[model samples]
Target: MEYMKNYKHWLANVKEEERAELVALASDEKELKERFALPLAFGTAGMRGTLGLGTFRMNEYTVARATQGLADYIKEQGKDAMERGVVISYDTRRMSYEFAMKAARVLAANGVNAYLFENVRPVPICSFAVGYLGTFSGIMITASHNPKEYNGYKVYGSDGAQLSPEATARVVSFIEKRDYFGVPEATVDPSRENVMGKDNVKLCDHITVMGKSVDEAYFDRIAKLSLSPEAVAKEGGNLKIVYTPLHGSGYKPVTEILSRMQIPYNVVPEQAEPDPEFPTVKMPNPEMPDALTLGIKLAETLGSDVVIGTDPDADRMGVAVRTNKGEFVLLTGNQTGVLLMDYILRRHKEKGTLPQNAAVVKTIVTTSLAEKVAASYGAACYDVLTGFKFIGEKIDLFQKTGAHTFLFGYEESYGYLAGTHAKDKDAVVSTMLFAEMVCYYKSVGVSLYDRLQEIYKTLGYYAEKTISVYFKGLDGMEIMANKTKALRKVDIREIAGWKVASTVDFLAGEKTYSSGKKEKIDFPKSDVMKYFLEGGDWVAIRPSGTEPKLKLYVSASATTAEKAAEKAAALLDQMKGYVE
Candidate 1:
C-alpha cells in the first residue's frame, strides 16, 4: 500500500538517533501502522502528538511543514500580513522553544515579522502579545494539560480570540492547498529573517533562539485585570496559601502576581521549576487527583488553609480547602466557577461597583448554579460552545456594543477568568482571585467548605460529574458515531431512578419539552445531547472536542449535597447502560 511506502519515506528523513528509534519501531507492523498512518491532523486547535517520525507524530519535519504552510498562507495575504506580523511563545514542554522558533522562522521567511518571546510564557501572554503588538496572528506551542509526551500549536486572530470559524476554514484551506513543502526553498531563506538578526533557522533547530522585548508590555496588559489591589494590600499576609504549577509555565506569572499583591503563599518546590517531563505529576491536569498529590501534601505540611494547582499551560486551576470539620476536600471545577462567579458579582454589588450592563458567559455544559446567581444580581448569562474562544468572541462583542459589560467567564473544566482584559482563560488572574477568596472566608471565621454549605443552604445544593469513554482509531470512530446516533432516536425517560423531564439535542439544534413543545437552538451544530430531570437536575453527552473520547457531563440540584452527588453518579452509571 502507498501508506506503507510513505511511512518508509518519512523514516528515511530522520536523523541518526531518531532514525534508529523509527527503525526499531518498524519491526512491529501493527504498531508502526498505528503510528504512521494518520499524520497528525491539525484541527481548530492545531497539531498535537507524541514526538516521533510518523505522520501522526510531532517531530522537527512536521513542525517545519506545518509552519511552512502557515507561512505560505500569510504570504498569500501580501505585505499587510508582514506588517501585521506573528507573535510566538512557548511553555516548559520539551522542544517547545525549538518549535516556537522554527515556526517564527517559517513566518519570517515569507516576510512576516516574528515577535518571539525570549523565554517560556503562559497562553494568555501569547494572546496578549498579539494584541499588544498589533500583530495579525499569534502562535503558542504548548499542550494545555496533556501528559509531558505531548505538545501542541494553537493559533489566535488579531482580536485575541482563537481563530474564528471562518478564519479556521481559511487556514485549513491554506494547509490543504499547499503542494510545495519539499519541492523548493523560499526566495528569502528563513535562516536570515530574524529581527535580532540572529540566524534562527540553523542555530535553534532543536533552541536558545534570540527573542524581541515583548514580555514587559505583555505583563502590563494583564495587569489591568486587577479590580482591588487595595483589598489585597490591606489583607496581605493574613491568610496562609499553598500553590503548585505542576512543573510547567505557570510558575513565573503566577508567582509574579501573588508577589505583586504581597500575598503570603508558599510554592511547592517539587513543581516550582519547569520540567517538560512534568516529573512531579503523573498527569499534568489540575482536575486529576494524582496531578495534585505533591501539592496537597505540601499544603498539609504548611498547615495552609487553601491549596491551588494550575495545569502546565496555566490556563486552568483546581483548588482544595479545609472544611469546618478539619477535613480537606477538593472542590469540583463547577463548584469553583460558581464560587468565583458569585464572589465577583456579589462583591461588586456590595461595593456599588456592579455595572448595569454587567453579564457572565459560560459554556453550555457548565453548571446552572451560576445562572441562578447571575439572575439574582439582575445580570444576564449567555451560554456558548465548549471552548474559551467562544467566550472570547462574546467579550469582543460586548466591547463593541455596551450590550453587556463582560463581568466573568468560566467553564466547569477548571478554566476561568475574572475580567475581560485577557480574552483566554487565565490562571494568573485566577490565582489572585481564588487566593483572596480564601482570606475573605478566613476573616469571617469560616473555611471555604463552610461558605459552600452556606451557598447550598441559600441556593439549592448542586453536584456535577464528568466521565470520558476513550474510543481509539477509525473503527472506534464508527462505533462512537453509531452510538451517538442511537441516543437521539428516543426520548430518555429515566437515568438511574430520576425521570427525564426534557431533552435538548444540539446536533439537531432543537429542544423538546415534556409538554410537547420544541424550540430552536441558535449555536453552531455540534453532536452533543443533554437531558433535564425533575427538580432541576441535568445530564449532557458529547464527544471530547480535543481528544478521541465520548464524555458525559451531569449536574444535579437537591436539598442535600451528599444526595445530589450520589444521584448524579447513579444517573451516569444508568445512562452508560441505557446507551449500551
Candidate 2:
C-alpha cells in the first residue's frame, strides 16, 4: 500500500513521458512493488541499480537527490567546501554521461562548484582529480564491471578515497530527509557539447568543465611510478602485449601509459572503443576470463605472450601470461598481487631505495603469501578490511605518523595500487607497472609465468579461490543478513579436517583462539568472519558492499602447488556447505 502510494506520487509529479512507464506498471503489482518497495540504497560506495522509472532505480531524479544530499553535506562544511566544489566523471556505461551531467547540474543548483570532465574518464582519474583540483569531493558515475543494465554513483572525499562509513552515514541521513520530487532542479542546461574545452564556455556560474590538463597531470604523476626504466628500455619493444578494454573507458589511459613507456602492444580492435552496450562481453569485468577471450585470441595471433584486460571503469585490471607449454593462463588476483608485490620489493631493494619502514597492504581475504614476501624483504605487511578505502586510510595514517612507508596495496579482487597518486585502485598505473614488470622479467631471461612459478618454488606454493553466491529480489538483504547470523551461531571448529586455530568475527571486532584467548581486532566492525586453520590456511566470509552477494574466500599454502590447490578447493567446498 505504501509502495503504491509512493508510485502514485511519482506518477503524478514526473514528466508526461515518464508517466507512461509508471502507468504501465500499474497492472503488474509485483513489478510495481519491486520497483517502489524501497529507495535505492546509498551505502559507503554510493548507489547502484538498474535503469528504470522507479524509486529503487537509477534515474535523473535519484541522481539529483543523491547530489543534492551531497551538496547539502558540503554546505555544512562551510564556504570553503562550496568554493572547492566537486569533480564529476563517468564511464562508458548506459546513462553514465547523462547521470554525470545531472549530478553536475544538481550541484550547480545547490551553489556548489562542479568540475565536470569534458568526456568519459575512468575511476582512478576521477579520484585523482578530486585531489588534483582540491575539490571538496568527487563523484564517479559507473558500476565498475557490472552488467550493462546497471549503473552506479560513487562518492570520494577530498582525500581521493571512497567516502568513509561515517561520512556516508551523514550523507545518507541528509538523503532520507528529502523527498525524491522535492529535490532542487538542475539550474543549467547540459545540452551543449564540448563546452568544457571552450575557453569562455561555462554551463553555469558554479560549473567548470575540465579538459585534458587534468589527464596530462595524472599521466605525468603516474609515469614517475616506473621502477625499472632500464629493463623497460631493454625489453619494452620486444615484449609484445595484447590489450582489451572490454568496451569500457580504459582504452586511452592504458594505451597512453604503454606508449609513454615504449612498451609494444596491440589493442583488441573489437573491444578498443567505448560502447555503452559492451557488446563484446556478457559483463565488462576483466576478472572474468570470458571477457578476455578476444584479447587472448589477439595475443595468439600477434605472437604476444601477455594479455591484459581492464574493467568498465578501469579501476581494476586482469592479466594472463603465457606459460612454458605455450599456453596462456589467466592469473588470479592473488597471484598477480603477489607477483607485483614481489617485483616491486625486489626492484626497490636492488636499487637500494627500499625504505627501512617499507610496508605492503592487503585485504584480510588476500593471499597470506604477500606477508611472507614482504617479510623476506624486511618489509611489514598489514591487513585491512575488505574495501580499498581502508587501504587509503592506512596510507594517510602512514603519511602522518611516519611509522611505515607505504610501498604497495592490493586486494584479491583484481584491484591494485602501487603509488599514492590516486587513493584508489588504478588500472592505468597497474597496466604501466605490469607492462614494465613483464619487461623486467624478460630482461632477466624469464617470463611472467616463469617468475610466478619461481616465486612459488622459493616461498612455498600458495593457492586462493573465491566463491560468490548471489541473493536477488526484495528479500535478498534480509536473507544475506540471516545467513551471516546463522554462520556466526554455528560452531565452526574444523573445516575440511583442518582444526580452526582461531575464529575472527569482524562484526564483533574480536578474535577468539582455540586456547580460549580473545583479542580485539584493530579494524572497524563489519559483517565478516574469518577462520584461521592450524596449517596457516584461512577462510573468510563477507557480504559484498556494492552488490547483493555473499563471498567466501579460501587461501591455502603448501610445499607443492598441487597440494595447495587441492587444499584450497577442499576448504572452499566445505565452506560452501556452511553458507548454504
* TM-scores, one per candidate: 0.92, 0.98
Residue lDDT tens for model 1, 1-580: 6558767786666667777777787678776777766667776677788776676677667777777667776777788886777878888998987788677767666666776776778887787767776878888898889888888888888887888877777777777655323522224335543434332333322222333345556556556655555555666677677889888888878887778778878999988988988887778999897877777788888788778899888999999888777667898898899888887887788779899989999998899888998998888999998889989999999999879899899999999987765678888888888877766655556667877788789888888899888777745656777779988887778788788788989898998888889999898888899999887788888876666778888888888989888988888888776455
Clashing pairs in 1: 39-55, 39-56
The CA lDDT at 184 in model 2 is 70
Segments of candidate 2 deviating more than 4 angstroms: 189-193, 196-201
lDDT per model vs. reference? 0.78, 0.90
lDDT of 2 at 158: 90
Predicted structure 1, TM vs. truth: 0.92
